[model samples]
Target: MIIFVYDNSFEGLLTAIYEAYYTDIKPRAIVSDEYYEPNLIDNRIYIESDITKSNKVYEAIKKKISQDALRHVYHVFLSELKEAPTVIYKYLLIAFRMGYQVDFLLTNQHVLNMHKISKKVSREKHRMLGLTRFQLIKEDFYYAPIEPDYHIIGLLAPHFANRMADQHWMIHDVKRGAAAVYDKKEWFLTEVDMKLQASVGAEEELYQELWKTYFKSISISERRNPKLQKNFMPTRYWKFLTEKKQS
Candidate 1:
């Protein structure tokens, strides 16, 4: 049994496929850097990430699978689910064995599992965009912090740009050390260090006060139930939700 290992990145996964096929050996397992076993007795191959090889695999997938199928697979890859990588690999293994019909993903149990996981991930990405509340800063740049479980920075960038087109703003994914900045006509993604906004001093506290007041006024104490609030606005997420934190 041959075991192939590569870096734990999407590009690395694709490049590993290129090496796997080139070696013309059936791989017993495809493992990532995070799961490398030090004491391996099998015929193990270590693969480096190569953009060219990754591109070739992408091209092959596109040729065999429909564009929509590829997108679904990418979404599943981005789901941040613990089993996503393995499930995607199984889907690919089956796709290679069966020719170009990735739509069978709709029916295959393993593929279907990925579809569900991906959908959940995408839903969370969209929800965070709606829930994120930005504070207008001194530089006229709107900013917000989110610690999403997935790499959703690229996905949530568009909503703010479209809704507040005339404003300069940024939606930072603090967990990922990245942000999407938008001007009226253009947007760019940037990487920044993980640090709190240095300028958010006593003045920034005003927004917290206002948000807390608004939350209290809106809350119908007669009908308020902690259980209901917990269901939608989880306590785990309250740290970044200024209003929730204030209340």
Candidate 2:
């Protein structure tokens, strides 16, 4: 069995698939280099991020699956879930096997996992949309920070761009060390050092104070259930979530 390994980027994954089809060895699995563990007899192919080959795979997927499906795939990839790459590989394999008919991915296990991941990622994306109140910095650029479990800044830029078209905004995904910036017309993502001390929103303290008050006010002394709340909002997520912090 063959193993195709690539960097974690979406383009890198595509290039691996491109190589998989062109290679003589049949693949038992296609996964990221981070997940790669060499075997005694298995064939291993290390695929690099090649723009030309990646573009070819990209175009093929675009042609086969609608733009909407591709977008959904992007969100699922950004989920950073352990099985993300495998799920994408399965979807791509089915797409190749079934041709255009693979577009009906809802029934397929691989595609369904992608859908489930997308929905989870999207719910977090939307939650951050309202929960992430931006801070006004100098130069009229609105800056906000989010440490989402997934890389969802690009997935969310269009909404803010449409809502605040006249203004410039940047949403930094602290966990991924990337930020999405939108200047009136176009949008793009960039990598940045999260280590640098970022200035806080002038109103951040006030909102935080208010957020605490609200959290306190919402409780019913007779009905409080810490166990249920923990089950719903795991403690690990509290660090980045504004509303999830302690009073």
Candidate 3:
């Protein structure tokens, strides 16, 4: 078996795909060097990320396939699944051959797997949009921390950049040690320390209390359903929710 290994960057993965397409031997797997495990039986090739080659693959996907297909490929990459590289490679091979019609190939396992994983990442992004809770750390600065299952901090940046155009804010993905920081004009993603320290002021503390109180006051005790609540607001996300915090 032959495997293509690349640096974990999206461009690197694209470069690996480009190399795979040109090579006489089709690779059985494409993986990041970070997660690669050596095997004596398997032939491994390390792919250097070339922006020119990566961009060629990127433009080809956009022009040959549909723009939506390009989006699916990116979303699947953000899933951070170990098999994501191989899945993307297979999906793109079918996409290049089938053109836009690849989306209609629901029965195809590779196509279906790509759609499922992409949808999962998209769903989490949607959930984070509503569920993210921000605390005012200082004057005009807000910070929100999330621990999503997928690498979605970058996906969430544009939404908040538009919504909070006038305020400096940050959305930190604690689980991944990465953050999307907005400086009132634009946003950028960067690596952050796992142990981020931000002090909540007295006003923010009071606001948290009021918000938690409002949450409880609006709920009808007699009709309250923990199961239903958990369905909407998963227990996994309660750690960052102001209303869900223990008062």
Candidate 4:
């Protein structure tokens, strides 16, 4: 068995695929360095990320496949599943062989799995858009913290950019140690350890309390169903919601 190890970046994964195709050496597995475990029976091949090779592969795919197929490639990459790299490899192999119609090939297990994972990622992105709550901090910047199940800050950036076009805001992914910042015009993503002092502004605290009170006032306790509430807003996200957080 042959295993290919990459730097665990989307570009690196594409570069590995390029190398595999050019060398005519099909790998049994394609994994990132952090996830790789040494095995005596399997020969390991480490692939260095090359922008030229990655771009070549990307352009080739764009020309050979439909633009919608290209979007699926990016969405699947953002899915962040452990098996994503290998799954993308297999899915693309079938896509390139079958052309644009590969998407409708639901009977193919690889195609079906990729579609499912991408849909899960899309749902998480949609939930974050609706559930995200911003709090005004001392420096006049709005900060919203989230712990999403997937790395979806990039997916969430454009929506907030349009919604908060006049404000400087950040949507931080606390679990991933990364954030997407929008400064009234453009947006960028960064990775930094946040040393947030629990020094929330007094006005912010007042608004939070008001919002909590409003939430309480709107609730009809007699008709409340916890299971239905959970279905709409999962319990895992309660930690960051202003209304759900313990006072």
Candidate 5:
């Protein structure tokens, strides 16, 4: 068996795929070097992230396949599932042979897998769009922390940037140790090693209390349904919600 190791970045995965097509022997697995533990029997190939190679693969997909399929590739990557890179490689292999029609080939497991993972990523992105709540922190920064199952912080950035274009905001994915920061103009993602100092403003505290009171006042005790509420707003996200906080 052969294993292809990459830098864990999307570009690195693309570079690995580029090299895989030209190799004499096909790789059995494509994995990030960070998670890859060397095996005694398997042949390992380390791939460096290359912009040119990654761009070539991207352009090829956009040209040979449909733009919609290219979007599927991105969404599947954002799923961050363990098998995502290998599944993408497999999907592309069939795509290169079958052209744009490969997307409709539900009989093909790889294509189906791509669609499944893409759906998961899209669902999380949509959920975060509605469920995310920001608090006013020190230095006039609007900080929102999320713990999505998928790598969706980047996906959430554009929506908030457009909605709150005049403000400086940061969406921190605490689980992933990454943050998407917007500075009134552009938004970018960065890896954060240390915990952020999340000191809420006094006005923010007042708003939180008021919001919680409003939430309690509007709910009819006899009509309350915890199960229904949990279905829409999962219990896992309650920690960050102002209305859910203890008075």
Candidate 6:
């Protein structure tokens, strides 16, 4: 069996796909170098990320397939599933042959799996938009921390950049040690230390207390439903919520 390994980046994945199309020997699997485990029986090839080749594959998908298919491909990449690279390659193979009709192939396992994974990533992006709560840090800047199941910090940046256009803010993905920072003009993604410290002001603390109090006061004790609450706001995300955190 032949396997292609690449840097754990979307561009690198695209470059690998581009090479698979032109190479005489096709790769049985495409995997990120970070997750790949070598086997003596399999021939492993390391693929270098090339921007020009990546762009060609990206444009080909948009042109031959559909814009929605391109979006699905990107979302699947952000899911970080171990099998995503190989699944994308197989899905694209059918997409290129069938064009837009590939989307209707619900019977095909690859196509179905691609849609399922893409929808999961999209759902998390939507939920995070509402669940994210920013706290005033050091009197001026706002910071919000999240540990989403999918890699979605980049997806959330544009919304916050437009909504908080006048303020400097950051959305940190604590799980991934990366953040989307906005400086009142543009937002950019960068790596941050996992042990990052940002002290909240006294006023911010008071505001959090007041918000918690308000949340408790507005609730009806008789109508309280723990299961329903957990359904709406998963327990994994409650650690960052001011109201959910223990006083």
TM-score of each: 0.73, 0.73, 0.86, 0.85, 0.84, 0.86
lDDT of 5 by residue, 1-247 (tens): 8999898888898899898876676898888776788769888988989999999998898999889788898888777777888999999989988889998999889999999899888987888798899987555567787888888887888899999999877677879877676667567666545454445555556445434432332243442211108777888988878888888
**Which of the two, 2 or 5, has more TM-score?**
5
Residue 179 Cα positional deviation in candidate 6, in Å, after optimal superposition = 0.4
Q: Of 1 and 5, which scores higher on TM-score?
A: 5
* Better by lDDT, candidate 4 or 3: 3
* Candidate 6, position 200, lDDT: 49
The lDDT of model 3 is: 0.83
Q: Model 6 compared with the native: what TM-score? A: 0.86
lDDT of 6 by residue, 41-143 (tens): 8899999999999999999999999999999999999999999999899999899999988999989999999999999999999999989999875445678
**What are the lDDT scores of the predictions, listed in order?**
0.67, 0.68, 0.83, 0.78, 0.78, 0.82
Clashing pairs for predicted structure model 6, backbone only: none
How well is each residue in 174-199 modelled by candidate 4, as lDDT tens digits? 78876677657667676535433345
User: Candidate 1 on 1-247: residue-level lDDT in tens?
Assistant: 6777788767887788777767677676677767776675777778899999989888878777656556666777666554565676777777766655655647788767766777777887777876687877544556777877777766777777788899876676767666676656656666544455444465566445433433342343442211106755656667778687653
Clashes of each: 0, 0, 0, 0, 0, 0
How much does candidate 1 score in TM-score?
0.73
**Which of candidates 2 and 5 reaches a greater lDDT?**
5
Off by over 4 Å in 6: 197-228
Point out the higher-scoring one by TM-score: 2 or 4: 4
RMSD of each: 10.9, 11.6, 10.8, 10.7, 10.9, 10.7
